[model samples]
Target: MINANKTLSLAIMSGKGGVGKTNLSLNLSYALNTGGNSLLLMDCDLGLANLDVLLGISPESNMQDLLTSGAKPSDIVIPIEQGKKFDILPAASGVPELVEMDEDMQDLLFSKITELVGGYQYLVLDLGAGINGTVLSFAAMTQMRIVVITPEPTSLTDSYALIKVLHSQHNVSDFNIVVNQATNEKEARETFNRLNMACEKFLNIKLKNMGYVRYDPAVTEAVRRQIPFIKYAPKSEASRDILNIAVKIQKIRMENMGRLSERPVMKKFPTLDD
Candidate 1:
């Protein structure tokens, strides 16, 4: 169990699917856990839950069970790394009802999440891709929102669209950008700069570059083997990049702690009225 002080909530989202969002979320959680933080990784992709598939763990129950059956959050949490560092709340894949939740359901879901995350140092939500209502609600509530994108023009455009929605509708200003599957640091920086310029010019939002992950074949191999790349290939270029980003995240948390004596007030989950 983590300290009872306060847990930092982070939502990792993408503008579109197949941008390696789930892969990055899993590896980043592992890296943060290995670096001595207790984390709860929630697979918020209600329609397609792949975190359990990536880890080769078949969960008996998931967020769907919790929402539909009134199951306790503790009942669905699966421990990882010998139950020492990380826990995962898997989602029910291909469940249409879990995709677009109504107001009451959303409130019930986040209430359970708040209860479950109390003992965690960090709660990492791997939200579904795109700018759906559920995704926007989770992103708006989190203390840190990370938007993952690639060098593809469509990826950049969709990411900007998501950011714009969050800014205009949800009043979210701060965002952390991660460039994934880049060939080199230069490519990653170029991608971030392009997105940053657009966001600044139109939305007037500044996106902090959270660094990038290099394109590594080992990542594909690890995915094929259903193992997290950080553990499967600790020395791989992609794993190294993830670790660097984890370090930056830890530093950001420490800096935020210094500035705020009390726990930051998280935005409430959006209701139907919202």
Candidate 2:
């Protein structure tokens, strides 16, 4: 179980699109909420938002309404289900300004979001693919960062690049790795090892392996049906792997609870109390 005193914020990101980063974020969130812990899944994909689409929901208001119309954060949050303690702060798609929001706009969003932080134990941000200034800033704000990758040459190269930028520019050294679409456990380890080797040698960073999710047809069906794979096929291989990963991550969070200090590097994203 997570500590209630503070929210364990995690930013799930990727180097490129089409790597199942968003899907992993959605399902991982559901898995983490199994202990009746409340979580707020924020779609920080900005200009290309789509968490609402995957959940088969269309909210009346979103982050846009809060920033532009002075809407309350409570009014914009959409509960994933009536009884489940899960909610998502969906973002607007095709919004140009949202892609590269000015520092004032970011501060406004962060301030508004901080108002509701006390109500949830988790704040899971599904960031847009690739590394932009917005992506780096949001990724740094979170206590944990999970980089999703597949067993592809491009994925390895691009993911390394993303990690490099964060570590070199933003001073974000710690990162978690999630291997997606692996055919088997051996394949998954090989993928992680190859990426780890590159990082260890060149970037001088060690990535915590959060385990892997094998390719499963159930995932495709779940997406097609606009539902999470964990809900769609609870007994599936992919679902099992994700739940296991969630357990691993929970253990990590518990161990690091005492050291979950706020990154004081980004002056623009300071806490309201700061």
Highest TM-score against the true fold, candidate: 1
Per-residue alpha-carbon lDDT of model 1 for 36-117, expressed as tens digits? 8999999999888899999998999999989989899999999987756699999998898888887788888877766668
Q: How do the predictions measure up, each by TM-score?
A: 0.94, 0.93
- Poorest 10 consecutive residues of model 1 by lDDT? 265-274
The alpha-carbon lDDT assigned to residue 70 of candidate 1 equals 87
Best by lDDT: 1
> 1-274 in candidate 2: lDDT tens per residue?
2223456778899998899999999999999998677898999999899998899988898899999999999999888866777989999999989999877898888877775865777789999999888898898777778999999999988899999999899777788899999999999999999999999999898888989999999999999999999999999999999999999878866775555444321233232222
- RMSD per prediction, one decimal? 3.6, 3.6
**Clash totals, every prediction:** 0, 0
